[model samples]
Target: MKVLQINSTVNSGSTGRIAEDIGHFLLQQGHESYVAYGHGNRPSSSRLFKVGNEWDRRMHGLKSRLFDHHGLGSVKATKNFIRQVEVLQPDLIHLHNIHGYYMNIHGLFEFLGAAGIPVVWTLHDCWPFTGHCTYFDRYACDKWQQECHHCPNIHGYPQSWLIDNSRSNYRVKNQIFNAVRVMTIVTPSQWLANHVKQSFLKTYPVEVIHNGVNTDVFKPLDAPGAGGRYALNAQNYVLGVANVWDTRKGLGDFIRLRGKLDASIALLLVGLTRQQTDGLPKGITGVPRTESVEDLASLYAGAGAFVNPTYIDNFPTTNLEALACGTPVVTYNTGGSPEAVEKGVGYVVEKGDVDGLALAVRRVLVQGAAFRVNCRLKAENFYDKNDRLQDYLALYKRLCAVASHQTVYDGLQN
Candidate 1:
């Protein structure tokens, strides 16, 4: 079977790596796998297809910023990609993060609807259904249920400064997206699945597949020098990590939590910009993002507890990574962040509760290495990369088999 996966990146961020992992799994099962990506030059095991050029993305961004028409740009790029897809004739198409200023959604979905290819779309966020923002919980907006207009998050991601075209965008998306006949929607969190069921896309089947982590690389490390490498005092620190740091990620809450914590318990925040790191308050160590998974594992292993104060997320892989490293996690009760923490493994505090976060971190620090075994067990049982990848392979086989049977049945009827 041939499977083509389309995403915004390849072998890079969480979603990119997931596409790579699934491609690798398919190849191992003796299936041809291809990845078509819009950005990032990361090497992948699967056959690679570059979707669009930088200029295409720039134009798309300009269109979005000026006209609030994000997915409508890149018409030529989408048409060219459609030609390539027709030539490949893959048995299935898997979609991820298609809103990343690359593909023209109208053209792409029109092709999908006409071609009648089996599709399994993994929604990494709510952008596909919503008109403006990838997430709307922060603003407490529910307009996506019926219609999206006068978007509250108009200035958010896929940011539009000049116009609010959400009403028309929503109607157009509803018409185009629902045109596809054979499709399944997969969300990384049940919270997101519930939201999907409430949206216009509720007619399609929705599945919850929590994101997984590489346990072998993320497991407990014996690196004693890890502390000194990051200028950490010892294993007496609470760690916070994010791909990008901002107020939405609860960066300010971490700053407040530091004052409530004991001076002996150091605070280390990873994945900060150099400028952000330099401007950090005292008693908090800021480290820039590290590409090496081993380095992250070392940091996770050496820390007493992992804290994620994010106000918005969809089953963050950081929580699983920390658990795989035998480090307990304390996260906010926002989105699927708390789902990674099982009882006795960690704690889930209410969102923006600096005192609650501090108390949870202190509790974990007091318990020390005692929670390590439980944390590792939880990760292995629920978030193992191998198991999760296999789930995708199984889904692929089922979808392809059904499609093949339907094709045969149609031939018989004719």
Candidate 2:
């Protein structure tokens, strides 16, 4: 089988890594695979395509900022990509993300509809269905259920400084997106899948395949030596990790957690900017964001507990990583986070309850070693990267069989 996967980034970020993983997996199975990405470093793999140049990407972003015309810019670049797609003649076209100011989505979907090829779209977020926002949990908005107009999150991602075109955008998206006849939607979380089933995209089937973690790179290290390398004091450490720290991700809750916890318990956060670390409170240690999975595993191995206070998320890989590293997690009971915390592995506190968060942290620390073993067991069973992605291969085989049968039937009728 020949497969083409498209995403906004190639070898970095979560989605980019997922795309790369799929490409590599297909290659291992002795199938032809190609990856097309908008930005970031291209992997050294056999077949990788750059969708647009830096200038084209910048122009696309500019158009979106000025006119709220996201997914519609970079028309020529998208057309060129389409021609390449036709030449490649992939047996299956798998899409990860089409946003990020790189593709003329209307044009791309139109080509898919006309071609009638089997397409599998893995939605990392809800942006494809909604008019403007990628996430609406903070607002608890249901405007996306009926129609997306007068959008409250117009100022959010694909941000527009002027004019609200959500009503028009919604209509345009509905018309273009539904045109594809042979498409299946995949969501990483059942929560997002449920939401998709209630939206205009409900006509298409939705499958839930939880995001996975590479266990080989994320496994626990010898505990004592791990903290010493980072110059961390030998005290109980509550760890939090994010690519960025903001209120939406519970940065404020971490601050509050520090104030409430005793001085003996240290609060350490990875993925903070140097400036953000400079004036941190007395008991809190902030390390800059790391690209090294080995470094992350060391930090996770040394921690007493991993705390995730994110108010909005879709199956966070951080929880999986922490568990894979044998660290117990204490996460908020918000969006699929608690799903990562199985029995005896972690605790789930209500959202925004700093007191409850503090107590949960204490509870995990008290049973730290026992919980560590359970965490690793849970990760091995449910969140192993190789195991989770096998589902995709199964789905691909089923779809290919169906398409082959249809082709034969059509030939017979003609």
Candidate 3:
């Protein structure tokens, strides 16, 4: 089988790693694989197709801001991509996170509808269903259910500075997206699957496949100097990691925890930008963003507990990573975060409940040394990277079989 995976990046970020994993999995199974991505480092094994350059990205972003055309720009590049897809003639096309200002969504969907390709779209966020924003949970908006006009999150990501074209964008997206005859929807969490069922995307079958982490890299290590590097011996630390530190990821919640928690227990935050980490609060230790998974694994092993206070998330793999490192997790009950953290492995508090969050941290710590083994076991049982990749391979084979049968029937009729 020949597979072509489309995403914003090839090997970096969560979604990119998913695409790369699928590519490598296909190759190992004696199938051809290709990856088409917008930005970031491309993996060495996969046949890579670069969608657009940095200039194209900047221009598309500008156009989106001025015209409220988040996905309608970059026409020429998208047309070229259509030709490239035609050449590949993949057995299946897997799509992930197309809202990164690279492809002209209108052109891509039009091609898919015309070509009648078997498509599997893994929705990493709610952007595909919404008019403007990737996430509406933070805003508590329900307008996406009816029609996404007068979008409340227009000023958010892929921000539109001038016009409100959500009504038009919503209409156009529905028309083009529904034109594709064969498409399957995949979500990383049941919560996202439920939301997709309530939206225009409900017409298709929805599958829930939780995201996985590379357990081998994230596994517990008794490395020398792990504790001393972070000064772990002197203080009890609660660890938090994010690609960015902001209100969405509970930066403010951590700040609030500092005042509430005992002075002996310290807060350690990783993956902050230099600017974000510049200001020093009395009780929190801020670390800049890192690409080294090994470093993160060591940090996770050293910390007393991993705390995720995200207000909105879709099956965060960070929880799995922490668990893989044999660290107990205390996370806010948001989206699929609590789902990854099985009973006995971690604690979950309601969103924005700072007091509850702080208590959960202490509760996990009380569970102590015996509980760390449970965390690692949970990761091995549920969040192994190879098992999750196999799930995708199985889905592809099933969908391709159906597509083949339908093609044969259509040919007979003709």
Top-lDDT structure, candidate number? 1
Please write out the lDDT profile of model 3 over residues 56-99, one tens digit for every residue: 99999999999999988878888898899999899999999888
How many backbone overlaps does candidate 1 show?
Answer: 0
> Which is the leading candidate under TM-score?
1
Clashing pairs in 2: none
Each candidate's lDDT (Cα)? 0.90, 0.86, 0.86
**What is the Cα-based lDDT of residue 109 in candidate 1?**
96
TM-score of each candidate?
0.97, 0.95, 0.96
Ranking by TM-score: 1, 3, 2
TM-score, model 1 to reference: 0.97
Which residue pairs in candidate 3 collide? Answer: none
Which of 1 and 2 is the better model by TM-score?
1
